[model samples]
Target: MTSQTLLSHVASILDAAGVKRGAIHDVHTNTHLLRHEVTTNLDATVYRPLFCLILQGAKEVGTSAKLLKVRAGQSLIVSHALPVVSRITEASPDRPYIALVFPLDLDLLRSLAPAVMPTFDKAASDPFSIFRRDMDEGLEDALLRYFVQCKAKNTRHLLAPITAREIHARLLIGRHADVLLRLLWHDSAASRINEATREIQSNLSETIVVGDLAQRIGMSSSAFFEQFKAITGTSPLQYQKDLRLLRARDALRATRAKVSDIALRVGYESSAQFSREYSRKFGKSPRQDRNIAPVEQQQCIADPAPR
Candidate 1:
């Protein structure tokens, strides 16, 4: 089927299931279905590696430095964890915004790397960990079949994995091939920066010394600083700061922990400073109710909603 036809089918699936607003997790496929009925204000969250396919409407997703507009029939690939702000740019009761969110398994992508033909792509010159492009027919078809598989209890576990593998394999050979290929290559700068990101995420509250991270990743301070920003689109220190505030925001919404304690948990020794930063990021006080915050795993800060 054409991409348009597949998108409409996916829309029908979500509409019939009554997911006309916000997001719902798909237990079987381990993905999230997102929908919105109207345009929205900016929402912030940290995005992990995932695939997001927009079936209807459009959105504006941005990090500190990059802003991308994605619409229906386009797919977005987030290759690393990054904090982002986003707004739904187009939606209405008659034609809502709809999309699918599937987490990407870097290890699985790594395991499949050796099977592909190699190429020379400069990871340093590549400035983004998030990419958006048209959803090709093959990928859309595989995704549609994967959704269909999830509908049958028997095929959910059995055939879904096979189709999931097929989808990743298709991504490996698709337009995203270069960036994905670079990130998976063991000694590439993209891989090294990927390592750095994991270390930062592992301890968001802990103080990060860029020099130490550079040494740990086998690059000098200057080289690491430049390449890390090149690949991830933000400085190392800023990346850690953004992630810390995002995690703290999640804690604020999900728990009754005191705001000061949440700040300490995310590595801030000064509660006042943490509160100030949180307000700047989310445009609300740390103590405010986060009824509008996106769900934890939905991580679709990229797919926003009206609030």
Candidate 2:
């Protein structure tokens, strides 16, 4: 089946199954299903691991210095914890956005990548793991079957994990396999930066000394800095800033605490500095941004919303 045909099929299934389209939180497990229009643009939380595939409509994810646009038939994968800003660029009451996200099972990816003849980008310039396009019919077919099986309450526990493996396996052989492969290895610069990226995430609320992180990763400071940019497309320090701001935003949403208090919690000694950076990243200051709103009401700040 063509990508368009598969997408139409998935949409029909979701509509018939009565998938509730809306912003979801605390709806745990490895995957989520939905149908609806959302407001107050949602920034995807740092997924210790995440895979997002859109069956209808589109969304954009900003990571470091990279902004990836994923639409129907294309998927985005984040192997390491990365701060990302995501928005639904295309959707409506009649034609809503449909997506599936599976958290990374490192053990499974590591186990499978070595045996497969996956493609790797020979060009060292591209540093993202996103498979923005080129999702073939086979991959889409596997995903459709996986999501269908996932909705069965009784079989999910026993079968979801098995199917998740197949999803990753298909991803490895697909067009974006090289980027995913880079994420799994440790010898490459991208892999090293991924390792460093993890360390930053674990201690987002604490002070990060970049030099120490470089040393810990067994690379000299300059070499580490250069390689970090080469792989992730952002400096190590800027990466940390993104992590800190995202954490503060989460806290503000979930609690009634003062903005300054949230700032201090995320390692900003100066509330003014935190607010300044926060405004630059999210396009709203901490105080102004905190005006609580429903998930469906907010739109992304990067690209204008589609009417």
Name the TM-score of candidate 2. Answer: 0.79
Q: Write the per-residue lDDT of candidate 1 for residues 1-307, one digit (tens) a residue.
A: 4656656766766677787778876677777777888998777777777888888899988775888999988888887777777788999998888888887777788788888846636533455788888988888889889888887889998999999999899898987777777778888887788889988888778899999999999999999999888777789989998888877877877888898888999999999998888888777888774555563344453323110
Q: Model 1 residue 45 lDDT? A: 75
Pairs of residues clashing in candidate 1: 205-266, 205-267
Worst 10-residue stretch by lDDT in candidate 1?
A: 298-307
TM-score of each model, in listed order:
0.91, 0.79
Candidate 2 deviant stretches above 4 angstroms: 1-21, 25-29, 34-48, 117-125, 294-307
**What global local distance difference test value does model 1 have?**
0.79
The prediction achieving the highest TM-score against the true structure is 1
Q: List lDDT for all candidates, in order.
A: 0.79, 0.66
Quote the positional error of residue 200 for candidate 2 in Å: 1.0
Over 2-62, each residue of candidate 2 has an lDDT whose tens digit, in order, gives 5555456555555665655553321223454445554226554454455666777787776
Give RMSD (Å) of candidate 2 vs. truth: 5.8
Model 2: lowest-lDDT 10 consecutive positions:
298-307
| All candidates: CA RMSD (Å) | 3.8, 5.8
